[model samples]
Target chain A: QQQVKQSPQSLIVQKGGISIINCAYENTAFDYFPWYQQFPGKGPALLIAIRPDVSEKKEGRFTISFNKSAKQFSLHIMDSQPGDSATYFCAAITGNQFYFGTGTSLTVIP
Target chain B: SQTIHQWPATLVQPVGSPLSLECTVEGTSNPNLYWYRQAAGRGLQLLFYSVGIGQISSEVPQNLSASRPQDRQFILSSKKLLLSDSGFYLCAWSMLAGFYNEQFFGPGTRLTVL
Candidate 1:
């Protein structure tokens, strides 16, 4: 079974628009949630992360909104740029293991 | 600062051939290591993980196996490669301080089995 589920297999946005990708998990044991960005032929890099204690966290143009009761979290990218075109993945960590969402391919058109 | 490395960034092997992929971490000790495989434009599938030397955990039952020979060295091996084994392999490590920590990933190894 997929522990974490992400919506919108792909997304497209114009420059300066807002892009959002959402993920949901059933495991309440997850204590940490992180978002990763990956360019083609490269490793995924940590973009932003949030703990369950906080409902929201923002880093520059990237923001993570987490809802514990709903068991959901969403990543918001503001002012999307062409350079931001890449794949994004949301992951939940519990114990020493990580459960990842399938992934979302985001494209920003200039 | 710590960094991870994976050798033979790209590999192409015929079916039934033996395979070995190596991953190492520098400037860190006793890190929690992980191995993942990803199909084209797909999500990451956790294959194996290790928290300590000589300690390994398999998340999925497959033809592949993993070993942690040292504090920072992790290896993935397959006695006989299958066409289904073709994919991008990734190595990641996180601090052992607590259950929750950011994972650092290596560039990844692309394996093509004919």
Candidate 2:
């Protein structure tokens, strides 16, 4: 069974628009939540992370909104650009293992 | 700074052929190492992880196996290749202090079994 589930396996947005990717988890023990952005033929890179202690965390145009009670987290990309097109993965770490969602493919049309 | 290295960025093999892929980490000691496989249109699947030298935990059963002979070196091996093994392999490391709260990954190796 997949411990973490992500919605909207694919997304398309226009330039200067917003792109949202969401994920939900079943394990309450999970504390650290991180989102990774991966380009084709490259390794996934850390995008933004948020803990349950905070409801939201933002870096530049990227923001992570986490809801502890609902056990959901979402990534919002403001002013989406063509370069923002890539695959995004949301992961939850518990103990020494990490559970990652399937993934979301984002496309930003200029 | 810490960095991870994976060898033979790409590989092609035939059925029943032997396979070996190597991964190494720099600027850290006794790091928790992991091996993950990404299949087409699928999520990153954890294969094996090691917290110390000569120790490994397998998450899935397959023809693949892993070994950690040294603190910073990890190797994935297979006695015979299978067509289903074709995919992207990623190596990652995490500091034990954080207990896997954060991890870094290697560039990944693309394997094609024909």
Query: What are the clashing pairs of model 1?
Result: none
> Chain A structural similarity (TM-score) per candidate?
0.99, 0.98
Minimum summed lDDT over a 10-residue window in model 1 chain A is located at A92-101
For A1-110, candidate 1 gives per-residue lDDT tens digits of 99999988999999999999999999899999999999999999999999999999999999999999999999999999999999999999886768889999999999
Q: What is the C-alpha lDDT of each candidate?
A: 0.95, 0.92
Error of 2 at B86 (Å): 0.3
Give the fraction of true interface contacts kept by model 2. 0.59
Model 1 Cα RMSD, Å? 1.1
> What global local distance difference test value does model 1 have?
0.95
Q: Model 2: runs farther than 4 Å from truth?
A: none
State the displacement of the C-alpha of residue A101, model 2, in Å, after optimal TM-score superposition.
0.6
Q: Candidate 2, clashing residue pairs? A: none
